[model samples]
Target: MLSDVLRSVRLTGSMLFLVDATTPWRSWAPQTEAFRRVVLPGSQHMVSYHVVTRGRCWAGLRDAPPESFETGDVLVIPHGDAYFLANPPDARASYGPEEAVAFFRQMAAGELPSVVPEGGGGAQQTQFICGFLGCDRRPFNPVLASLPRMIHLRGATALDGAMRHLVDFALCELREPAPGGKDVQLRLAELMFIEVVRRCLTTMAATQAGWLAGLGEPMVARALTLLHGAPARHWTLAELATQAGASRSVLAERFVQFVGQPPMQYLIQWRMQLATRMLAEPGAKVSGVAAALGYQSESAFSRAFKKCAGAAPGGWRRQPSE
Candidate 1:
C-alpha cells in the first residue's frame, strides 16, 4: 500500500553529496520555492534532508531554538521551509537567499566537487551528506502531508543505528566511484529516505492524527490496505466494512477521523490519482482510462475527475504542471 502511494507520487531523488565544514560555519537551506528549480526542475514539491555521518551540528528553522545533533542523526525539512545547519545552531549565515540560489545552481550543474568543503579553515570539522528529493504534491500526497515541517531523529536508539549504517555504506560507494556508483547511490538515497519515513511512523505519538498515523490503527489500517490494494473494485460501504470486520458507522467515523474522508470518498481520490498517472502516458485516452479504473463511461470518469481535481480529465491531463 505504501509502495503504491510512493509510486503514484513520482518520487525523484537527486544531487546527493557529502559536505565537510569547518567550525563557525553555517549553511542555509533556502526556501524550497526559491531553490527547487535550481535543484530539481519541474518538480511540484521539494524536501531537503541531511544525514549526520560524522561530528556534531545544530539545526532548526530560522529564529527557532536550534537542536543539537551528532553523528548518526538526521534532520529533515519535509516541507522545504527555510532552515540552517551550523557548528553553533544560531551562527549567522555568511550568505542569504540570492547567494544560496547561486550555490544550489552551481552544485546542481556539477560545477562543484562531489565533496563540498566549506567554512573557516579552523581545525574543528563536521561532516554530513545532503540530499534533495522532489515529488508530486497536487491531486494527492498523504506521505508528505502527514509529516511536520521539521523532523529530528536522534542517534542514540535503534532507528539511529540502522540509519547510520545505511548512510555509511552509501557514503563509501560514493567515495570510490564504481562502474554503477551513481545508480547505486540514487537507489540508496531513496531507500534511506523511505527508512526515515518509516521511523517517523513507528515513533509517532498515539495522539497523532494523519494518514501515516492511521496505518497504526488496526481498523483504519485494514480499510486503507484494502482500498489501496484494489482501488478498481466497486466497493460499497457495507462490503468494505464487512471485509474490515467493522460496522459501517464505526468504519466511516474512524476513516474520517484518521484520513479526513470516508472509505468511498478515499477510493474516489485514490482512483483519480491512478487516473492522472495513466493519462500522462503517451497515447492514453480518456475512455480507456475510465474503463480501466471501473468507471462505466468516459463522461462519468470526467465528472469525478473534475470534482476531485477542479478540472476536467482532458484539461487536467493537458496541464503543463501535470
Candidate 2:
C-alpha cells in the first residue's frame, strides 16, 4: 500500500544546496501555498528538508514550540507549512516571507550559488543542506494525508547502520563536491526522506490513527492488502471479512476505526486514484480503463471520477497544468 501511494506521488526535480551560516542567523521557509507554484509550478506539493551536518540549531513550525536539533539531525516539512531554523533561537531573519519566496525562486532556477552564506558572520557557525522536493498530493495520496505537518528525526535512532553509512557518504560527497555529485545528492535526498518515513512507521504508537497506523494492525492490514492487491475484484463486506478471517461487523468497525472509512468506500477512492493514473498515461482509453478497473461501463467510471475528482476524464486530461 505504501509502495503504491509512493509510486503515485514521486519526488520530482529538487533544488539542493549547502547552507553555511554564522551565529545569530535565522531562515524562514515560506508556506507552500505562497511559493509552491512559484518554485515548482506544476508540482502539487512542495516538501522541504534540512540535514544537519556540522552544528546544532533550533527548528520547527513557525508558531510551534522550538525544537533543538544537533549534528546529524534531520528536520523535514512534509506538509509544506512555513518553518524556520535559527542558531540563537531568536535570531532575526534579514528577509521576510515574501523575500524568502523570491529567494526560493532564484534558488530553484539555479541562479544562486551552491553554498549560500547567511547570518551575521559571527564566529560560531552552523551548517546544513537545504533541499526541496516536489510531489503530488491529489487524487488520493494516503501516505501524504497521514503525515504530520513537520517531522524532526534524530540520526542516532532513525538511521540503521546501512542508512547511516549512506548518509555519511552522501554528506561527505556534498561537502566535498566532485563530478556527478549533483546526481548523487539528488538520490541521497530522496532516500533520506524515505528512511525518515520508514522510521516513523516503525515507531508509531498503537493509539495512532490513519493509513500508516492501520498498516500496523493485523486485521486492518489484512483487509487493506486484499483491497489494494485486487482492487478490481467485486468485494463485499461478507467476502472481505471471510477472506480476512473476521466477522463482517467487526471488520467494518475496525476498518473505519483505523482507515476512517468503510472498506467499500475506500475501494471506490482507490479505484479513482488508479483511474486518474491511467487517464494521464499516453493513449489511454476511458473505456479500457473503466473495464480494467471493474466498472460496468465507461459512463459509470466517468460519473465516479467526476464525483471524486470534480471533472470528467476527458476534461481532466485536457485541463491545463497548474
Ten residues in sequence with the least summed lDDT for candidate 1: 155-164
Q: In order, what lDDT does every prediction score?
A: 0.83, 0.82
How many residue pairs clash (N, CA or C atoms closer than 3 angstroms) in each of the candidate models, in the order given?
A: 0, 0
Error of 2 at 15 (Å): 2.1
Off by over 4 Å in 2: 205-207
Tens digits of lDDT, candidate 2, 1-322: 7777777676664777888999889988878779888777777788888888778899999879889998878888988888999989989989987788888888777577667888998988898888777887766777777777887878686656556776677667756878877677777767767766677677662657788888888998999999999999999999999999999999999999888889999899888888878887999999999999999989999999899888899998887545
lDDT of 1 by residue, 1-322 (tens): 7778889988887667788899889988768888787677767888888888888998988857889988878898988798888987656678877888988888766666668787887777898888887888878788888888898987764235567678878788767667866667667777788788878777763557788888989999999999888888899999999999999999999988987778898899889988888998999999999999999989999999999888998898777652
Worst 10 residues of 2 by lDDT: 158-167
Q: With candidate 2 superimposed using the best TM-score fit, by how many Å does residue 57's alpha carbon deviate from the native?
A: 1.2
